[model samples]
Target: MAASRNLPIGFEASVAGGIPILRVIHESTAGDRLRAVHGILNGTANYILTQMESRAIEFDQALQEAQAAGYAEADPSLDIDGFDARDKLCILARMAFGGRLKVSDIPTYGIRQVRAIDIHSAHRLDSTIRLVGSAEQTEAGLEVSVRPWLVGCRSMLAKVEGVNNAVFLLGDKIGMQMFYGRGAGGDATGAAVVSDLIEIARDLAAGQLSAKKVSGFLDSHDVGICPKPRPVSWYLRLTVKDQRGIVARVAEVIAHRDINIDSLEQEPHLPKERLSFVITVEPVSEPIIQRAVGAINAFEFMLEPVLLLRVE
Candidate 1:
């Protein structure tokens, strides 16, 4: 039936049961033109990050707690690896921009490397971290990514804690609109199903039993994905086996890229064998920072890969 109707037929169909579905495809109406859509779509990732921030726990500890709370699966690869959020972002981007999108097309960065020291640095800056999936339409084209973002303490994204989810939509006419609630769990899912059923029942009573096709899905144009670099403040956490000359080596790389370091901090009382260096750089384009990070990661002293986070 979906094939005949030329519907958006993929993930939802596999698990939606027999219920009639209605989705708010942003591009379907002419009343508003979408500018951007950003969301925290994975409950497990959110739960883990929340625990790490509020409880001052490590990534593995938070993951264990999330598993015990039934928020995370035994494997949890999709959630931890950011693929789940990437898939959700693709659907949202397709709806907002009216084009075909694949999960592989979007750049994805997971939260597995986030450490307690990174969380402490964010706390010092009056901010918190969350995995954000975002799609924005620019003059060049659509820019999309799924990664950890440093959200300010006063921002709406930071207020979204625990297993709750939030989606922020920016439109031409509406400006900014936020939708927040429980993004998972049986109770929330059941409520959503019942809401859809009630709306369908009402439409049926009105003698309008037709399915509304998603205009964006129906459109055939391919979404142009342009990788435009935007200037942003960054949080970099590097764990090294030795601290000697490590800062100078990393600083040289950043200077070579013409990026200025706003501040550099190293937490005290850490073992000399395993030290953490937190660096905050002035607003610079992502490509510049990526280049510097690439150079820094190449150093033999690095115990693990450097963690790069976008500062809100």
Candidate 2:
């Protein structure tokens, strides 16, 4: 096709390994642009989270076990640090808007910070952990982020978990549509790559194409990060090697912040030397609850910082 006039495009495989995804492109008519993308590029972290849930092991221990099991790479930073997700998002965003994006420009958070206490607390609130990578039109360019978000059970977004990936497309006329499927494994991702290659080859064979839909991303919009987000309940877990005055100390911090505790429980099975103090606060702004958690975590009796979770 190159011998003749051709403009074949589309990258091979996921920018990262094992994320079953692709970007299909074509000449756009006078209509809103469309794109197809896949996510969840790493199976190591997904498998670790899954096994941890079943084994009821701590995050650190589970990660170590995963490394031993050869599921995780020697340096698993990219997978766990949300960098891989960012790459996938960039591909999706470029296809959606039609421009280039710097991966470093996007903010990302990994599940490494998530704790077993977080899992338990989410369970208490009937929610779960999900890695969400999103790019949405904002007054400023496109607001984008990849991080673990607390999602309610009833929300369709919450249904994506483990190694599965999903994508969402919005258009003036098309509205909203979401695509979901297994997001990891070589075979699945390879198939996606080929799909895009095939389309690009066909388009190249057809003739030169216009840039309207292809270049939408080049139009820069400010990237807005949601601040003062909606109110939601929260969980705070304080870890300490068993000691007296722990409760009183923890209570004082909670009270100072004017945070109302809807429920409080001392985690069962925690040794006296290492106790887990769990508390749930009523619905409030994320910043406020995080402030209280920060204050309480500063207490000397705290073995590790307070683990915070958004409760649905």
Q: Which candidate gets the maximum TM-score versus the true structure?
A: 1
Q: Write the per-residue lDDT of candidate 2 for residues 50-124, one digit (tens) a residue.
A: 555556678889878767765566787866777766766765665565555666877677778777766776666
Candidate 1 global CA lDDT score: 0.76
Worst 10 residues of 2 by lDDT: 1-10
List TM-scores for all candidates, in order.
0.85, 0.67
Model 1 is weakest, by summed lDDT over 10 consecutive residues, at 14-23
lDDT of each: 0.76, 0.59
Model 1 spans > 4 angstroms off: 1-22, 25-29, 192-214
lDDT at 202, model 2 = 37
